[model samples]
Target: MKITTNMHEGRRTEMYACGAWNDMIITDYLEMAVTKTPQKTALVGYRVHAGDRSAMSYSELDRRITRMAAGLAALGVEKGDVVSCQLPNWWQMSALFLACVRIGAVCNPLMPIFREHEMQYMLAHAQSKVVVVPKIFRHFDHQAMLQGLRSELPDLKHVLVIDSDDEQSFEQVLLQRAWEEEVDTARLFAERRPSADEVVQLLYTSGTTGKPKGVMHTSNTLLSNIRPFSERQGLSATDIILMPSPLAHQLGFLYGLMLPVYLGATAILQDVWEPAFAARVVAEEGCTLTLGSTPFLADLVDIARDEREQQASLKTFISAGAPIPGALVEKAASVMQGTKVISAWGMTENGAVTTTRPEDPQTTAVHSDGVALPYMQVKIVDGEGHEQPAGEEGDLLVRGASQCVGYFRQPDMYQLDNEGWFATGDIARKDATGYIRITGRSKDVVIRGGENLPIADIENTLYKHPAIQAVALVGAPDERLGERLCAYVTLHDSSATLTLKDVTDYLVEQKFTRQYLPEYLEVLAALPRTPSGKIQKFKLRDMARDIFQGQASHA
Candidate 1:
């Protein structure tokens, strides 16, 4: 099946004949760009600490990748070998990933913020042999964390450090061997190239519950999700993509690294998310597009509103992770001038399955995740696997080229039912126009007074408040209401002391139903978030359980 045309005239083209999944992987696109636009700027890294910037043209990046692949080969890395990376959005991370692909090694990218415990679990689960990381990031001493985990992780054979002042720096490896000295292992592993069905990465979901689950993806699965967005957004070599999302996260990997390079576009990478810094990068670098979480967008909007010329070159803002409030969407569109604010929905298991297209109507663009990408199928189904009628909300099940192969080492979680659909764990509804609106996570729905309450609705509503920095609503056990809404709020400014009355009064003003209003409010200095900036609601649930237990003891 092929995407025909946009509503506009003369915008049609036959889809590339590559298999649905094969087109999305970086290897195919990397080879294409190296041949076609070797001189184009493939990646640009902006350093915050030194105020120094660096860039690599496609030809240069390809050469460095070849050498790096050779370096890995020297270290005994082979096809299916897991090479874990804990670097930020630097050029080395991108180069290392391509090197892994060139040699058919599975790239296991971890957030730089991960400490000993998280690193141990990821390395052990993936059985990663080579771990590449930074010596220090922010205040976290990654070297110490690596040292602590190195003993227990028997499979870890090498530790490659980037941006380090220490002896094990990545630069040392390249300097020790010239490009001519290293063999091009890309050809040596040509026959072993990961097929469209083979796993390329073992991405761990933010362990909000139990231990983190490793979501496995093949080259085909990764590309299938990317191709649709590239086609939908009309991504091109002329566009400069700036991604504030962590490269470790699925969105960042697809949009920041793969999608931009897939289209031969320049990709601008930043190590961290700072609204002011992002604004400067977008404006100075002439970034045409960017994607980030709702909070990132909110912060950018606030920054743009305060500064007159912020994000002047940005043409598109892709918001995901959490609900994009209408106000933030409007603010982004207005500030960016001709920019479209697109709401996208997906998870670690599936790269963005649905997103608002460039030509979508404003209402649809603002409120919905838009239509499913080509080669992807989505359905709203009841608990028993029966499809629900249009305009009804149910568990969202998705199947497509981009769907993950399965969880690593967990075959039980990998098997699909006889029907072949993967349960997405999200509750969503499709309108008559085919736009999908995510209602809430299956676990996020609060059953209050025998009625289901959508947490997303309440959270989006709370986002409008001037003092509320972040809000998450979780269900707490209640004797009367079955389950009651317990709001965990983080204030924008600590000086602005708030109370339960302050929250209830604001909800009343917003016209939230009394039943939907939070029965208890816990004011926190900050919300616990994963490395990807997703709110750790499971932690809040634990806190709520403790609050209830303490109250019960007193009673």
Candidate 2:
């Protein structure tokens, strides 16, 4: 077994003493649900591609976790080893995560869309002992891809296949029924459960830098994130949670799997992201709360607009991972009544840091990212690391128990400064009452002749335009001015294509400063985005270098 457990023992003790880190681990709560309400519905998962619906009771889930754990032990998985999986929102993922905790392995869930390049870097970083991949997901033969790279992944001892015609099927090997009959699962698990302070999860950042960084979090740190949202929202066993986001991401994992189990609530998982299908599941399953990125919220609202009957049960909609346009927030009240369209901001390093309260003033959601959650703190700092006062745009920093422990296998690279705060690389401002408004990325902003162009403000302005469907503002390379703002826009079907003049005219009407106005406009079929739906601005920057250069070069 690898020694990846509890690297920062002093930090854990301090957090626990300060009431930031609760002593309870995740499995303890799962077991509580098992013991208290064994027959209660724990999960309802839909695999749209396979045309199947799977459900599990608390008792059944408990047994499956046990069996899977025993099976993993038999396959030579041990404490502190990495159990990497790339799956959709499936019941097997839920079981596999619990299975990992049962034997004290770290869970490293890769995005299903990740091809060989990302997989190579991450698998090598984690030194993953086992990797679970879909046999064929979204028409890509994942098994074949991994099989081709097996020689390169020296630490990979086993490959568990999911949903395929293979001898080493995940269901056949790990999740086989009645493993306790052959082995002492309870005893095996009892001997292996990791402490709450030990690193048990690895979530990779979809970085602009070529390689992704694996952000490590212990049980205490993760729970510090979940508990705040749960308490603030008053989540309980009665609430039904719906997840349209990828479970591999922290947003889905926290609310989809961990939160429901922690609260002993029923969680509904939708594997495929069809807005219409998502609406049906919400109605049919009586889902109350959903948390996802801005696009998911938009899709849900679009479906709710058309399919009125499917939205009656939804109480809360938490939008994160991207900026929430003020227009989207204002549209929500009338479009989807009786639901809180809460805006939030967070990262893989810091789980759900700031979030607008469900009962927060309507304008707050439209104007600000959110207020800091309990035990999670956020502050703005100047360039020299001095804390900036409210209403001044500066670098955002966070220090709290919920923050990630460090980067996976690269502790030295996780640069927490002398004050124990992690630099968030976001330019933001806090209101007098402590609401943070994300202005732009520290690295993503464009400067034209020593003046910073308001990229996010321009994007938000363009989003409100009737003709534009989606918009991205990138810093185009300019030799003299250093950089210039270039707007890439996608037009709505109902509208005519917008020219550079049309875009500038709209921004002018919106009262945008001439300095921040887009110098060039490029129409794109779609904005290049990560699989999780974040706009890949770096790609846009590269594309910007080739456009409208002669005008800037000669002038």
lDDT of each: 0.76, 0.81
Residue-level lDDT of model 1, residues 408-436, one tens digit each, is 77766565655567887789999886779
Off by over 4 Å in 2: 3-10, 444-555
Q: Could you tell me how far off, in angstroms, the CA of residue 371 lies in candidate 2 after the best superposition?
A: 0.9
Report clash pairs, candidate 1: 21-220, 24-223
RMSD (Cα, Å) for all candidates, in order, is 12.0, 11.0
Candidate 2 per-residue lDDT over residues 457-542, each given as its tens digit: 56766899988999988887553354678888888873467789998887767644455578888888889999999999888887
lDDT of 2 at 134: 82
Which runs in model 1 stand beyond 4 Å of their true positions? 1-19, 23-25, 165-167, 179-186, 189-192, 306-309, 444-555
Give me the overall lDDT of model 1. Answer: 0.76
